[model samples]
Target: MDALSKSDPMLVVYTKMDGRLEEIGRTEVILNSLEPLWITKAMINYQFEIVQPLVFRIYDVDTKYHNTPLKTLNLAQQDFLGEAFCNLSEIVTKFNHSLTLNLRNGSGHALQGTVTVHAEETASSRMAVDMQFHCLNLDNKDTFSKSDPFLRVSRLSESAVAIPICKTEVIKNNLNPVWRPITLTSQQYSSKDDPLLVECFDFDASGNHELIGSLQTTIAQLENLYNSKAGANFYSHKGQKKLKGQLFLDKFQEKVQHTFLDYISSGFELNFMVAVDFTASNGDPRVPQSLHYIDPSGRPNSYQQAILGVSEVLQFYDNDRRFPAWGFGAKIPRGSVSHCFNLNASTNDCEVVGVEGIMSAYSSTLYSVSLAGPTLFGPVISKAAEIASHSVQYGNNKYFVLLIITVCNIYPHVTSVQKFYPSIVVCRMELSPTSKKQKILL
Candidate 1:
């Protein structure tokens, strides 16, 4: 009993936000062990330019007084078993890729054990793992009824223990239960060759679960079984009784996606363009009900907010910060509903300095142009596509972002975008009648 009475330890991670620590993620509890090695990994986004402060809190879960979801004590009221703080940059640079950080108590005294950090590149793409299982003849543990069965999959750690990654929902009153599919990340699933331990259990409401059986296999073996459609049958013993089961890998595929870092490292820059609607359906700009009305309280409407939110993040990539702002569905000062007319009202100077410049041009055009209808977006889209194509011809690493504030189908614009495939983004905003919120479609 003394060997089974040890504490269950767990780890919690936090990131600094606006001078305060906010919990971002945590590890699973390693139950009933003195020297537990958690196979669960913690992930954090790495930005080269910013100072990202991270905190790791360790605690011994008192199963007798489980309060937190991770079944651990509260950090503020109850002291963490120990805490450690470090900047993300220091982990990679100061530690030469890995370091052992000392954990300290609230009084700043060093704790017993050390937490190891082995920094690695964040995966460029996330891979989803799908798993399923079926029991052949599960052992019945319940006296009055059939046993409730469920499956739990855990990866075998380098530290000689299995750490659970995912679990299936319990199916009540069944001896041959086919459990539902479980999903996990590539990191959580670990490597295809790593030993994955699957265990079947007869679940109980009183917190004491009976183990029906267990099996040891790798993802590679499961995939082979799935492809052959003849899953392997295995057996285990519990006290003098024998248990049997079959496990299957439903589906497993990895999709790779390129991020901004991929393009940025290749000298790619984002070129921004804005197209605003001047249709009569917007109502009179002077009216408070109008979607285009500049609020009397100095708040921006949907269009202005969308443009700012996107452009602010993109401005860092654009070297010159020059944006071309245009208007459609309106009679410009030139007396034409020119879909590609410059909102700046200049024939030769279509480009604006920055996001503020785009706002100025849009506001100024409101006073000069008369709102007209029969909304069409193909022309502006085509014009932006033409500019993007020219940049491609010149071998410049330029990506186009087109912001369209209108309510109409632009099927031809979709075709135009597919023609060049020039890394284009179309952000559309429309106000919903039933809801006070504005809807955005990408």
Candidate 2:
């Protein structure tokens, strides 16, 4: 039982009599001490001569206990974890309860404490010391109101504990190894110009650190998706394009939902995947009508525009800065004779690969390749479905998105089949940070 345990105090004393400290049963220990000295700032000091070690015939507990904490240290704790172990005094404090230590003159000497402790990992036993000596008796405790204590130590209240940061990565979107540093209005400690540390409790950098990495960017898409949908909805409510309270509410909800700051505090992983459509019936490659068109001015077609816009915002702002782009309704780039349907899914690739490659190829194809007819939405979509269905195999963090790009021509002569469409499965992708998959549309 550690100092934080709330075990039975009587059991602790009983163990002392049994001379079987090692046989101490697991339980919690609660420290209930507040010197009258604390009130007058009478400079109440304590000296720890020897805290009674766990003596046990059959050790039980001291008093009330709660569920063992899942984990006690946070990531930043890694910096000095070994150091903490090397100097037991660091974890030991003036107010400790793991052992029923005898007070040196009973809580009014130079602060010091002792309790036998066992290492969970090593099982190595040693006397753990919690000391706070050398503190001046601030007879000025009341007078010290204006002066800050060089060192003030106490167990934190429930509300004072820091929240932990968590992450979720999309299969295709999280493809970056590095994150850009964010500028802080007020950088503190040794963290100025430093890369953001993910789980540090300092309110300042905890937020900035998560947003710069690859995960925050993927979350941004989810934000934009929410916003765009809402913006569109609010526009519909007014029966015209205009801002309204509902739109403002949407923005408020979005800020709360996706900002990496709040998510980290609440322990959330925000990752998502995006898949695009590519197929024939988009239009003849030679014509200016294709959704993947490269206009004479070199501007990309609208399909590329919508997808790229979303991708740009996400990649820049999310924790994962990469996305996998894919194409269907066409053969693998090198396949001879436009092979109708050989699912061309590459492990994760950047959106730039598809954007630049597709534009370049679309231009070249316009000049050198012939546009043939055969619209196949099913095969392309099915490929996306195959990837989406793998959530079970890949585990929970993975998700796939199929964003089909098309415009229908409602001519009565057209067939009623869903497969027959101006629509195309323009792109396919995996949206997890762990997945090394991408589909190039060239």
Candidate 3:
């Protein structure tokens, strides 16, 4: 498209779904280069049972739209270069998990360029390491007083790019500073044998940081330094000059963190539980603005959507689909405000048959019960803990998951959750209609 300068190329990825193309992601436009290597990665969930067809299209973005955000940019305004098509399974089955395909035009004629696709399985290990660092004798870079020191740890990629993993807080006016312990996960470092770049910088107020010293080492080497009670000497950016500053490891501990998949693969069952908020803050059930309002056109409300989204994925992992459902901040028949009550309106049994049974019970409770006072999470969490504790006592390998759906503020009862169940992993998801973003807290 460019006569004087090279073509500014960008790549768009799509997946064929039900006879239509759905865009998965797009790469950033590379300016003035015929061969462009993009750093942006498009993540896709690969299913082993089905064949997923992927399409890759290249475009030359105009110079006027170079400053536009990739998400908002219109692909119809750009010039089409070529495209390639392949199945996702083909790339994964390769020896090195990489495949190269020749590009073709709209008429299926061969083009000049070829695109290479590489598949890398994401690391599922949740293992992490914690270590505290301190400097012995550091080089001073400040003119008025001692230099404010901080440390930045980065992992070297296969292309030798330094990707920063974590950094320590800057201690003002200190030459030898002891930093607090920092944790590094296996996903960040990839492996203990992988090399890491540790750089000590003198923090400047004007944003121009001066590097005092740096060193290249691995996690295994740092562990050895902690065991031997030794310190490693720092050197300049180039290896020719060795500085007087020394880096010492104050503490090092490696934790074996197991992932969700690890537990499931080891014959552990996941027990699903749900709690819905029935407070007056949700507005009336008959109004369209209410979050708990059911539509006559069969459209689901926000609460129903949350239940379906989580239960559908987790139901396959559970051996029995019986889920314990409850409601909070509501008043039962001839009773005061109850923090927790069975969703099915059964006095003795709280467990529902399946996802359909849970949905039916929830709908029934909305009409039978009345919305009441302030929402409390302590009771629901305590009840879930009691079930989990009973299963553990009987030597049943089961993990309990409690999903709480509420629109009201939970700050009052958030602290008491740990007191009730310390070992339970709580994941809070906030979904908003005005905003397209979703926040997940783990």
Candidate 4:
């Protein structure tokens, strides 16, 4: 019945698991056309040992019943178009790597059209590709000595149609043309194992282009050639003549981003430390203009605001919520000036209970100590390194975070901390663009 009329076609594939056919994947519906080219691909895991029995079923969608076949769209109440059954192993064993099987109706009579299958393996992980290609010594299709070269990239889909995805800019009167790069995702572009066709053409102003040559290659193969610093040669006329054109991969980058569970499963834990700058450059705490100013209205200054903002997020990771708050360039209650003294004023206790405790200690330090001149970052950095070194000696698995708030000349001491510490984030605040300078240690 579907053969008698122009029908919307859909293909459903199934595999025999335990005596009954198990549905695998279905193609998209091609509307109002008897001969449809479905761009959707059906990917199956190829198993060598087991006899993977496959069934390809065609359907004519029922227009009245919302375009579903009669049994499923209805070809005027007869939805089934036709079906062909075969083992996947039989197709793979063919010499040509392609097979054309006869589609039979319910009464066992062969249909007008046949089902052709092409088998190819594909990579597992998805990739973001950056591709650029160039052609060399292309055959002149026009009267000129040189050929205007351009490339058309197409992806092979389940419908057996090569769908065009990208086209390069045409270069006139050039046998060798280096086209611009094209970016592709794994969904639109084939994976490392799947082959993509790149066809080189001689551009014509009349809109009639001539095909110079074509190359079929996988993303992984291009990457291999790039890694090897070699060029992949292209062929023409179904691999009979070796064309002069070669594809060179400009850049290839692959990344595997891990989830939060990945870190948790690996037994990783986070540890936090807070450092504060107590230099005279921050201004006198007694003055309202100072960064450490405590307003009468209880409005938090920049220093207090920064501590509260960072500690609030970091406290969740620390088991004890204990933070080591240290200050630099401050003269203690005693005559001596110190950079690594505890904000709590306790000689023995360096760890504070929580952010509230850190705040209480910081406020108490302001009243007790006097802001000293010439800020120094070395002592506090060395203090953190000492603690980190001790933890490593004890074989403790911990990530140390040292937060420093200072208006000091940190250049002389940065190299010392960076050479020994695992991670140190330097936050330069309240500075104009003209004053900023960057120096890399390594």
Candidate 5:
């Protein structure tokens, strides 16, 4: 807990304003240049970036010119740039990946335009994205008193300011409550590239009929909804060329994920093998001070704890929903020495999978036997590799024992031949010499 507190992945976003404070007997409230939109969208991780260090609102519904509807709705927009990411990437990078904009023009009519990105020569301390904003700037900075500016900026609150992602839905009059899907409702319907068909029911001053337009959903519109309502609605497909949709595993944290799920098998089945190290130096368990001591409460010392942790997490990954846990080292804890003992063959590993098996083994071994050590780790690796090394007699999901070598010394003796086994690797955990308790992901 103490170790975690010191570095709990600092998850804070700080934004402060700095200027010539104030003169003589006066003070001015610092204003933000851009706006913050804390939007929670199930459809996308939507965000906006400014190039010229200008601040603007991040919009959900795209518009060409925003003047009326933009003024009414409460939007959360964040201001960065003057103090944020000024030197991280180039200004063009921000523009090249700009968010789509569907806003209304100063003429109170909707207009469409794109804010493209480009990069300029690096200056100052680092490189930045050079930008090209094509939208009408309106040259109305002095008119920015929040009273008449068509585009306005706001501040991001201290709270998460995270809006709950709205579920897929269909709205009306531009005021229709965003729709939420129910059972059997297909989200395959898209509003892309089509016009919204509104079933409007109203009468004009002369009793003439009128029908308002709204986006309708269907498979033909695979990615679009009612777009006919607003001719500019097609802008929803803005910068489609820029979007390469689909997820890739390359972006995932491999170590953490592999530690959790073993997708090594081509078919859907569970099977795994486990092996332990029995090198000399693991002091006798009968001794209370050893890392493998069976504490009064009956938990293995840290050496055993590592095995327990690995076993605990692996039980869930093993096919047949079971695993074979074995130990190596000196002779057996019993009469003759058996190189391997199926830790969970006699009893199931864990109900919830993984760690439970190791824990159960730890509990069962407490009253019996003791710990010994020789300190050699090569045999531990070879033992696990032996199953696949000599013959083709293992399961397809054949994961060899992860020889958790808890020795401060031994790496120097390791050679190339030992490094050839892909499935066999040593998780070296030195109980001493570490300046602080380390929790390396691997």
Candidate 6:
């Protein structure tokens, strides 16, 4: 394809799902380079239980389609430069989290090239830096008024590509603006010594934004600016022209927050609590259309599936495996409508033995309790919060997970539910009958 110049190579990554190839991401075309090291990353959710096959194909992009966006470019028109195949787990499980695969032609014949795939866990680190920034003097890009300045911070990759990490709010008609403090995580900046592109742009109603100035600095340099009480001068896109603008760091604070994995590894337990919706909107339990209807074919209903899906994952984190289960918006036998009644029908105890105990309790409750109206989550949330607060008061290293399964649109007492115990993680699963889709909101 490139007769005069070296190949302008671009890499396309795809995941094989159910024998169909689904494009995940594409790398930018590296012009006039045979061995191009692409900086663009294709992120895929790695599942431990399943094998995720990945296909990497290279293409020689023609000069005519150089201006076209990589996403919109027709790959069929580009010259094929062979492909490589490997499972995502292969790269992740390696010593350095990298694997090299020899490229092969369409006929599975070996080619004269190899592609190296590297995997980095983005959420492994919880370290973050919060910094407050204020501009001193910015270049006036507007003709009628002062420039509406805003800052955009981008981390420069190994290939010098600007990957945006964070941005500040636009301060209208102001050359000197003090934006709110922004936090950048370790995953965003990669390292303190890595170069970061801080660009100040003049806000415009039109899509075309005028660049006031840009400067390349690192997190370390920003910290130094804060310590020395000095400002960094901004320069033009090409470093040839120096602008009369400067960026001052008001404050720089770096904090190391512990991740969920850290807590689990440190003997912290995640206790599970479940609250099921028994509102009339879910239909009758005897009817097949009901959300709580037990299937005779041994297939799980939406409610059962939701409970099993969440409980199974959390059960391993909990040492005791005793889950507090409750039912809301239903009238129990010989009682008025109870918002937060124990699923096991116990007056004193609400905790069940295990996931099986929860299922048995839920099934028995359906037969004994009658579905009532006006879905309320306040009582159930209050009960879950009470348990969580008790655990905290006892100095227990426990995190409560409250799973609420519902088929309704919204909770009436959502505000109260939101203001519940801070230590409790509320996961609301809403199952739609029309679409047969389940949406889990945290």
TM-score of each: 0.52, 0.28, 0.59, 0.46, 0.34, 0.64
Mind giving the per-residue lDDT tens digits that candidate 3 earns over 145-253?
A: 9999999999999897889999999998998899999999998998999999999999988989999999999999999999999999999886568999999999999
Candidate lDDT scores, in order, read 0.74, 0.29, 0.84, 0.71, 0.33, 0.87
Per-residue CA lDDT of candidate 1, range 340-388, in tens? Answer: 7898889887789887898888889888998897788878888887788
lDDT (10s digit) by residue, model 4, range 61-95: 66565544323433335388889988775555444
Candidate 2 residue runs with Cα over 4 Å from true position: 1-280, 289-292, 316-322, 331-370, 408-442
Q: Could you tell me the lDDT of residue 320 within candidate 1?
A: 86
Candidate 3 residues lying further than 4 Å off, grouped into runs, are 1-137, 142-148, 157-161, 168-186, 191-195, 203-209, 216-233, 237-242, 246-257, 266-269, 329-339, 370-382, 392-399, 424-442
Worst 10 residues of 2 by lDDT: 36-45
Candidate 6 residues 121-236, lDDT tens each? 56536789999999888988988989998999999989999999899999999989999999999889988899999999998888678999999999999999999999889999
For TM-score, candidate 2 versus 3, the one ahead is: 3
lDDT computed for candidate 6? 0.87
Best by TM-score: 6
Task: Rank the candidate models, highest TM-score first.
Answer: 6, 3, 1, 4, 5, 2
Task: Give the lowest summed-lDDT range of ten residues in model 1.
Answer: 234-243
User: Could you give me the TM-score of model 5 versus the true structure?
Assistant: 0.34
Pick by lDDT: which candidate is best? 6
TM-score, candidate 4, is 0.46
For all predictions, the C-alpha RMSD in Å is 14.7, 27.9, 12.4, 20.1, 27.1, 12.3
Ten consecutive residues with minimal summed lDDT in candidate 3?
433-442
